[model samples]
Target: MPETLRKTFAKWHHWIGVFCASLLAIFCLTGGLCTIGPAFDHWVSPLPPSISKVFHTPSAESVAVATEYMEQTRGEAPAFLRLPTPQDPVFRLIRYDGNAFQTILSLHPETGLPFKDKPSLETGFFIALHSTLYLNRKVIDFIGLFVSLAGLGAVISGILIHWKRLKSDFQLLRLFSPTPRRALDFHLFCTLIALPFLLTALVTGVWIESQHLVEDFSPRPVISVTETESQKNLPAHLPPEAYKELYQAGAHYWGKDNQGFFLIAPHQALLVPSDGKSISLTRPHLALTQIGVKSWNIAPSTDKNISLTAFVKGLHLMRWATGEMRWVVSLSAVLLWAALGAGSFLLLMKQRSALNRRNACPSRSDKIAFSFAESFALSAFGLLPLTLLGLLWLEWLSPKIPLSLSIHAPQGRVDAFFCVWIGLSLIGLAFSLFRWVGSFPFADKALRLLWKITLKGSVFFALALPFITLLGREWRHLPLLPNTASLLLEGHFVLFGLILFMCIRKNT
Candidate 1:
């Protein structure tokens, strides 16, 4: 390596790491948590009814059901019924009085009763916390953008630092090092090995968060459609059953045309002359035969909304790539946390050695302080996996619990799961503290082997996650054996842990 360039790059890497470590840590933790997002939805909602109980109606029928329910409950018709799709459990009915859009939910098929119960907080809570730390939204967005950019810098600098040793250090973890060197090795190994996932995550993170910028720059047309006498004379808000009426009208308008989904916005005119279709708040799921209304003639018939771009984006982010993929990401995150802790410890040990040499005999307080810091890091590293495992165990146990009569969803099992998981996390965290009690050193040989094995296992599981989902014949349906794939990977984890135990058994 050239002296000047090497020195310059080293300086940059060092400073950047120092500056961004805290933020990097937060991003790492959040990204890791998001690995379980897909599974979260399963817990958030009531267990779906038996497949046989679910009614598969034409899109038009969905509209009719929504409208009928609205008329009975609200005593007025809604100008809009956002089309029903498989994704949302409830259909949204919209009324545009003179000023604003009011929304109500039709609880069941042909039951326009407004959802009297409190809405589930899970969806909103995750979204709010994920984007902002529940702080100001704009500030959080800016901070997210900053974190993403910093991640970019860290990755670039990190790669440079490990450029030469990159291949050789792929399996790097010194067996018998003081803390600092060990920590460096651990850090290098993690960054070097998990580079691709981290990079993709970082880039995608920034892009996803910056969507508002595109909206700001894009051009939108002004809506200018003359309402028909019937539309003008129509009450400011249509009856609650407007959706059902619209759907029935549309069903008759387009015979046997079973478009999916609906959207209702009554305040806006039902036509956009600039675009070919009328102003429809709803759309169809069918790719080839999807219809978008450019205009709605209130005098003649009802209209179904159409637009293609929205679904494509929704599919990408939801990542319903199957349960196995979720498991892979979750496991990778677990490994990443381990790597971080292990590597950081190695680095700290190296530093401690230097301190010891400089002082010849360091004071007791300094040692205690150093020990406390190490314990904190290790706590973070250990707590995450324990928490995750607890959650999984909860999911496994949830089916046995009874349901809530007042709530639309099953409540007992999920509640129990959280309580037990959180409790176990606290307990496991206390137990893991034993690892930090000693200034003792372990033989590096087994630790080294363990790291390699875990790394390989993580990669194997990650690749396996997506492929298994894709290969399944009924990807959309529940797998007959939910436990099968996870159990195999878990067995691998147990075996890996056992192997590590044999390797480091004497050291502890």
Candidate 2:
């Protein structure tokens, strides 16, 4: 390839990659946390002793409470309610008028009253941010469309820039390479490691997001074409007494032990298999029943497109991934973030060296590149790590932070996360801009100190967390087995942590 073409590829990779870096960092961070966040959140959160008593309540009665509460409090009936079961005993009202993340409420099964307001846990907020970005479903789906496309461009440009080294340096990690080149090598290595995962995610992510963005994936469309004749004919509305009878029938047929695994809607009640038993998010395990129905009407989506789409979703979301494999998926996300960070760092260092050489009168592109580099630097070194440390501590410290003060707590610590990222990024950016303008001798030292402290603190905390949690009360809270999976997961964490520790060591 000509030198001009190679420089073009590098420019595309650096600029486009920087723009997506911070956003993808948020995605990966939240995705990784969501896997273990719920478990850790529950482990750290404490229930009020007064309201802590838990016991089984009939599914019908629980749904009855949720519906009544929804009607009385919100002046709108709940579209569906999750009935209480042994594993999760709270009555949850969700999906109102075919909309989610609206009017979600938890109620005591026996009393049908709201639980005391407290710090949000269970990682549902993080899950919501991951899938929907806390925006309207349609908006997020559309945003994902462009993000996936841009991701493809970034990937292609990256490949173009590294084609020469693809074979020879695929597994190469020159720890002692020149400072700027070493970061570049690590970035390339991480890119190679994460390529398969990234491609799979981009393709399937685009497909799934397009379904919702254009077709508007909703309950009506979900069932309209794919549902069976019997299912399409199933009545939606059921009387209160009929609901009770239906519950009794389900209990009898599916075993009393598995009762209440149902989502009650006015149109047709969906009784899904327990979450652990279900792999595909939108396929086979779903069953529909009407008021007088005694048999399960399993959804037979015979359409090949529907089946293929379900499999695609399973791939994109990794719903079928289990045990340490789920950790691998999460780790893939983190590695991709690390690659972006390394590339950002390499660019920043290169740009800084160039700026020092010229000392003044940089081009417009150089200025823009510096701004982007600085933003990515702040995001990579400061915002993400601080937010991670704060959230990590929150996981174990929630039970310790007395909730005696209420009504002001940010929902899910989202306010805290946002504030930290925004504030830290601005401060870091200000320092970089000031240094650029003033060309102060001490500015580099200040920036280096900030970088070292944040990176070291974040990495060390990550290294200590698992070991400490294992030895502490949080260990009892893990929804994991005392088996090889845990060992394998910790091993993966240590491996990644050590790699990061080395990167920090080299940079510092």
Candidate 3:
């Protein structure tokens, strides 16, 4: 690369990384958690232990049970039935109340009795945060699309800037080297290691968003329903027996090795089977109506274009992953975020070093901009873990507090997360302003003190999380076993907190 071209790429890479670091970090952490979203749901709200053996209830029966349970409890039938699997042998009925909240009901397969009923907030929160940044769907889609594109741009520019050094950069890490060189080496090492995974994720994210945008604006085909002899003979709604027949027909058409059928419409059902030996994870479906099995929709053609698209989507989403492969993907996401963070931090540090090397004082605007950037970075990095710890603490504390002072269930807890995050960011900004306005000789010390306090506070809360949860009244209700999600989360908090503390202590 020419000197000017190299500088341009480097400049764009640094700028994009700096601008999108916080959003990308949020995406990475939430996306990692969401990769195991089902596990989280199982851990947080497992099936009743009394149901010892899995019951093989027919799909239609399960849906009927779920529908009856929902109608009895919420005075309305569920909008959709998520059929039971062997792994999670409960009929899940989803009901939207035409507002921000939605209700989810899980019923026993055999008994047709309610196992759990709650707002669809807990597991959905992570997914919503990952997909839409907890904003309006339309607005966040655009923002997410832009951020994903910028992330891809950053990755490409970074590769261009480091094209020559790419071969040698992965050789070794020099911890004892000068700060700038060491930071650069560490950043490059992580970037190179996570390059392939990061590139696939970014590219697929862009593709997914583009498809969503297109679908959002595209015109839908209008299908006119003519009153044919078959349509006239069919009843308005299929009876329960008809559901059973439809399920049998659909199952037979798809073979025994299928997931389950979902009621897509009043009289129509769509059956989905497990992934097969192809790049496409999209399952073939058997569509049924009141009459009988209407059509067998085969899987999409395995052409080069379709296969490539499917491969990219499956790779990015890991929809076909199971067991330990999900964990690998989650860890890869975390490492990719680490790479981005390191790159952004190194850029900021290099800028600070350059400023320090210049004997002349920086302009007032430059000082303000630098201070703001530092504050934003500090809050962005610190608030995520702090918010998570805050939510855990709230979970334990909410029940104990008086009704007047208590935060309500899931929604209030989510609100508390945002409150804590915003509060912490404000505090960080205040400290940054103080550091900037304070006496020259003490400014650096003040800033360092701010970071040390933030780090120590975060570590304190992270360490306190497990004990608080265990000793609280809800301990008996929570799953705290070694393999459960509670213990896994607690271990993460302690391990990551200590690592963060040690790193900060050493560097600061």
Q: Which ten residues in a row have the lowest lDDT in candidate 2?
A: 38-47
Instruction: Give the TM-score (vs. native) of candidate 3.
Output: 0.78
C-alpha lDDT (0 to 100) for residue 495 of candidate 2: 58
lDDT string for model 2 (177-285, tens) is 7677677777888878888888887888789888776567555534555445644454444444444555565565555445434455434555544333344444333
Candidate that beats the other on TM-score, 1 or 2, i.e. the better one: 2
Per-candidate total of colliding backbone pairs = 41, 2, 0
lDDT of 3 by residue, 262-373 (tens): 4344333444554432346544555544424443322222343455555666666766676566666666665665566566667778768766775857777866766777
Q: All candidates: CA RMSD in angstroms?
A: 11.3, 6.5, 5.1
Better of 1 and 2 by lDDT: 2
Better of 1 and 3 by TM-score: 3
Clashing pairs in 2: 236-266, 236-267
The candidate, 2 or 3, that scores higher on TM-score is 3
For 279-371, candidate 1 gives per-residue lDDT tens digits of 232222211111223222343323343433333323323243334565655555444544545544444455456555854775666555554
Model 3 residue 206 lDDT score: 85
